[model samples]
Structure formats: C-alpha cells, structure tokens
Target: MTILVEKPVLALEPKDVSNKDDSEKEMAAKNGFFAPEINSFGNSFRDYNAESARQSTVEEFYRLQHINQTYNFVKRMRAEYAKLNRMEMGIWECCELLNEVVDDSDPDLDEPQIMHLLQTAEAIRKDYPDEDWLHLTALIHDLGKVLLLPQFGGLPQWAVVGDTFPLGCAFDDSIVHNKVAKQNGTTLPPAALFIIRFHSFYPLHTAGAYKHLLNDEDAKSLNWLHIFNKYDLYSKSKDKIDIEKVKPYYMSLIEKYFPAKLKW
Candidate 1:
C-alpha cells in the first residue's frame, strides 16, 4: 500500500550529541519538548527497583511474564491472534474499549490504557506537530491490549503488555502492528509500523540490546522509535486529556490511514 504522509516543514539537522547524562533532556528541549525529571510516582522513569506499593506488583508481573512468555507460547499466540476473528470495530471504538484496561507491568503508569495512548500521542503531537502519522501511530499502538477484554479472550496482563523482547530464533509476536494493523491492511509507513510494533521493547531501544540484529531498514526505523519511546515512557501522569475535544482530530487521521471498520 502507498502510505501518504505529511512532509516535514523543517528537516531536523543532526547534532553531535554529548555523552553527558543530561543529553536526553537537552535534546528534548531543543526539539520543543520537555522531559519531566520524575515520573508520577515521584520516581525516575522506568525504575523497576523503586520502593513503592506498585513495585511488588510490577516485579511479580515480570516474574510471571518471563516464565510464561516462552518461544512455543509466543508462536501459539501469533497463530491464534493472526486469525483476527475477534470482532469488527473502528479505531475510535477500539480506543474506547481499551479504557477498561491497564498495564500491570508499567511502573510509570497505572492509568487506563486509553489515557496512556492519548498521553503519548498528544505529547508527540506537541513536539512534532508536522508528523500526523506519528500522532496516529501513538494513538493506536496499544489497541492490541483489547485482547484483555472478555470479548477478545480476556488475556492475562503479563501476556498482553510489557517490555517486549524476542524468545525465539527471530523476533515475532502478536504485537499491534504485526498482528492487527498490518493484517487489517493499514497504509501507515514502515516507521509508524515499527513504532507500533516495538514501542515496548525497552531493552532494544533503551538498554541498547539487540543492536547487532538491526538491518538498514531496522536502523532507520529505530531512530523514529527512539524519539517515540521517550514520550511513551515519560508522558504517563495523572493529567487528563479531554477525549471529546481531541476525538475529531484523531478520527481524521484514522480515516486517512485505516478502513472505517477492521477485523479485531
């Protein structure tokens, strides 16, 4: 499919990034984005070892996830959800459905799934206003979490959301872009698809794992994913987005990139 996207009004010039610890904050500031110093829990972002009430719950969830997310198990999940036989709904409808879900593995966010989606998208939109495709990509990236709903088999939290990584010989799982949007015939660019598919892959993007596995295309996609990941990780707060106000804007993007109704 030929995906149409907006041309950036100003091409970002590459900068010689300093190895200083505050590089990320400096970069965000340069790009007209602000990176908060702490997360909603008054802890640093993605600090899994932080002492908090949610710490034990997050650790336990990871324990279960590591144990059960085996190669064979992921294969089964891929085949099962590839069917996309769950139901037909538009992007907005799926977003509404996700409001009932939350990610137990996310130490930074305990908000409903929809809030994170909007938070991430709005943050990106503010910083990169010309990138409409990116805004929509952020919005729908976690729609696959609907698998946790009863109508979609009510999958366990461990299986549905977390920092995704490979268990098999190669990387493949029932991620949003891999199993949902691509299967449903989305015309989003490869970069948008990459962000949708691997935004939770903290080890690769954040910890610098699996760098050797990246090809030329994966390398290019990783740059965009890196930019997207910051907002996805840090935008989680008690702040509320006015859904009714932003609905029309995202709906227009949805109509541009996706069919009115999709199979699950």
Candidate 2:
C-alpha cells in the first residue's frame, strides 16, 4: 500500500553526479541555494528498532546521525548558508528539479512530486479562507527535500522527511514508528519524553523545539510548516491531485500567501 511506489522517477542530471569531495559539494550547494541544518537530520527515524525486532526496538540513528550532524557540522552549516549563495536560480526551477523524484520511502503517497505539493496546499485552502500564508506554507515546507538533488545537496530520503525532533534536547516518545530508541547507546532518562512528533514545528506547539535555535524567517515560516505538514504527512491517497486543473488554483494560493519576491 505504499504510495511512493518504486517508479522510474529520479532523472540523472546531464552532468552526472560528481564525486567531488564532500566539502566541495557542500560549497557548491551553498552557491546554488541549499539551506543549512536541513541535512542535519538523516533517516535516523526510519531504522528498525532492533536485530530481533522484538528485543526492545533500537534504531541505528545515533550510529549515523550523531556523527553526520556534529556540533562542528551545525556551525559549518551556519557559516555556509549565512551568505545564501547556492540559490541564485529561480524558485520554480528548484521545484521542478524536486518534482523529478518521488519519495518512494514514504508509505502513504503515490502521487507525482508536484501533485503532492498541490494536495497539501489545496487541503489547507479548503479550511482557512483568510490564512494566506498557509498556501505558501503548503508549497514550501518540503523545499528542504530538494537536498535530494546534487546541486542542492544530495541527501538521502531518511534525512529529508520523517517525524522531526529537536537536536540539542532529548528525543520524544510520540515518534510514529517508535522503536528508534533502542540503539545500543540511545538512552531516554536524562531527556525523558523529549521525542519529536509528526507535524511538529511551531515553537508554540512543540514546546520551543527549535525556537531558540532558529532565526526569525525560519521561525515565522514555522506556521506554514505547521499548516502544510498536516497534509504532507496525512493527505496522501491512492488518488492524486489533477495536475492541470490544480496548477492555477495553487498559483493563486501561492500568490496570496507569499510576497512577489522571495530570496530562494
């Protein structure tokens, strides 16, 4: 029943994926508009709980995410994206690039990439007539997933989406596939019940998850993340959003929600 069926969706760029060093690729991504901290979280949440599947679920997250996302890594990201060089292109192009692939790892979605965005935006527009920013939220919250692209920062599916949690603090118990806590070293005592949940973004709702860490724009966009994530995570179906018909409606919504010009 996985909607993200294994379609021949990903298209290799004409230039081919470069084997350039990680640091060089990171720098190139900055020049192209990739954001920071998005890669900080990997598919940590996607790992199975344990070797036996019954011997107390333990996720292989700490073994990887801890090393990939170190203190220095966060600081390096901050320094890189502060200049925002990576995104010198049009936003539409980024969306199109992202649209080239589907999140096959996701169980509930079977739609095209663009259709998924439309579904999320349309679902919100149905409820809140006046919340213009919500339309923008639905459209952009998953922009971080563009990291799947090489130019944007070729991140794995596990990194881009899953139940999101806080970094500096401890993990929470509300995680959907809640076995990730069983890694050899994954302890829950000190940061008891700090687990991150689905649709968590607003500092208001998430008990200041990223409030202190995020800048104003990221914080403000937290609303859109909150509003859109409802559908991003839940709005999937065997059905799909009609691309031709839904495009104009979404454009209007985006116009209403976002300013005429955005940085990336």
Candidate 3:
C-alpha cells in the first residue's frame, strides 16, 4: 500500500496544523523560526539562552498576503473565533501565555515575554488616561498570541500572533513589511488580529477596514493601538524594562476592563 507524506513543523500545511490536539498542537506550535507561541507557557524560557539572526527582504511578505488573504478568508475566520468557544478563559492567563512570542531569532536584548507586554501597556497608560479602555487594550492586544500555547488554545503562529492585518482582503504594506510574513509563510489570523486592532466600539480612525471594525468598546480602546504600536515593535531594546516599577499602574487599568483576577 502506498502512503502519503505529511510535512513537519518547518513546512506545515494549514490543514495539518488545524487537526492537532493540544499536545500535538503544542509540539507543532514551537517551530521557532521566529517565536512560535502555541505550546508556550509561564516557564518555557526560565533557563534563558540566545538566538540567531535572520530576516527577509520586504518584498516577499506583501506578495503572498496580498494574494492569499481575501475578503472571504477574513469573514470566515472572524466567524470562527468569534464563537469564543475555542478558549473561554480569563484575560490574565492569556496575557502571560503570549510572552512566548519573544522572537529569540532577533539576537537582541533578551526581554522576558511579560516585560514586553508591560512596556506597551505602561507606555500608553502614561499618556492616555481618559480612554480607560485604551489601557486595557494595550494589555490584552497581544493576548491572542497565547493561542500558541497548549494550555490556552494551541493554535499556530499564523492563526494567533504576529503583525495582524485585515485578512478578508489584501495585506497592507504598512503593518510590518519584512522577514516574518515573508519567510515564515503566515501571519496572525483575521479574527484575533482584527479584534486587537479593533474592538467594536468607537474608533481613533485609520484607512480602509480599520474604521469599520469599531464597536463602542473598540472605538474607546483603539487609541492605545497607536500608542503601543511604537514601543511594541521598536522598543525591543538592549535593556530590559523593569516590570515591578510599572505593575501598579497597569493593575489600575486591569481593574477598569477586567475584574481583579482573571479566570483563565
């Protein structure tokens, strides 16, 4: 009897990734070309180490995303994750889980996963107070990245993390025009990324589909996206930002959108 060969982590098919259970999904999720979030947890990197350097020419990422991410794909994914059935948990655990995405490949400062998240949130909370949701938004925007962990949701890097864009249509060049979405072959899914970029409320405003996704909450919170975007991407500095110095401020923001402790 003849059998078919299935591709492994380095060359996974979308269907292959989707079929996995939490354990198998976790295994596949840590493929590590950049930093896969699917199988990660609180202590994955406690015994820290260094990583290598690699990047892509900006040209390739746009080419495929522009072609593959049609409007239909966006609608389909939004419909799927919006069910919230994939993982109905609390926000704090989700946030903690997202830290696995600290791309060791960058060969830069080895910031722990949680510190990067705090940097973005604290940076915004400093400047924007009236928009309470904006502070919470910064905290949770990357929570979808937790999907890379089996404990949370165990989705692939493409499904739950990375530079999110509008999936139902063409890829935008402005998001992040190099390396990852190029050599890695996928980016965040339309649903989580779309929700992070938008929330279904009022809006600060951007071009194309960005303006349309806001609900009252989304509109209220999106301002932080603008604030966090700078530090989240560019602020991966050589020095680690101190998390203790900043937690109380974010604790206040957490109290605003979520309860004192999250369920997940």
Q: Judging by TM-score against the true structure, name the best candidate.
A: 1
Error of 2 at 41 (Å): 25
Error of model 3, residue 34, in angstroms: 28
**Which digits, one per residue and each the tens of the lDDT, describe model 1 over residues 1-264?**
865655333234322222335767677667655767698889998777789767988888877887777889888998999999988989999999888997888888889999989999998887778778889999999988998899998989888988788775554443212221167877678888888888888768877777787899988888888888878887889999999999999999998888899997
* Model 2: residues with Cα > 4 Å off, grouped in runs: 1-67, 110-112, 175-229, 253-264
Provide TM-scores for the models: 0.85, 0.54, 0.51
Error of 2 at 44 (Å): 21
> Candidate 2 on 1-264: residue-level lDDT in tens?
533312122112212222456786676454421222211122222233323331121224333443355456657756664556555544344555666767644434434566666666666555544444445456555665676677756765555544454556655444434334321111111111121222433333445444566557554445434444444554444456666776676565444433344443
Q: Candidate 2's error at 142, in angstroms? A: 0.7
Query: What are the runs in model 3 whose C-alpha is more than 4 Å off?
Result: 1-52, 56-76, 86-88, 103-112, 128-133, 167-195, 198-228, 260-264
The window of 10 residues in a row where model 3 has the poorest summed lDDT is 7-16
By TM-score, the better pick of 1 and 2 is 1
lDDT (0 to 1) per candidate: 0.80, 0.46, 0.44
RMSD values for the candidates in order, in angstroms, are 5.8, 19.0, 18.7
Model 1 lDDT-worst window of ten: 172-181
| lDDT order of candidates, top first | 1, 2, 3
Alpha-carbon deviation at 32 in model 1, angstroms? 4.2
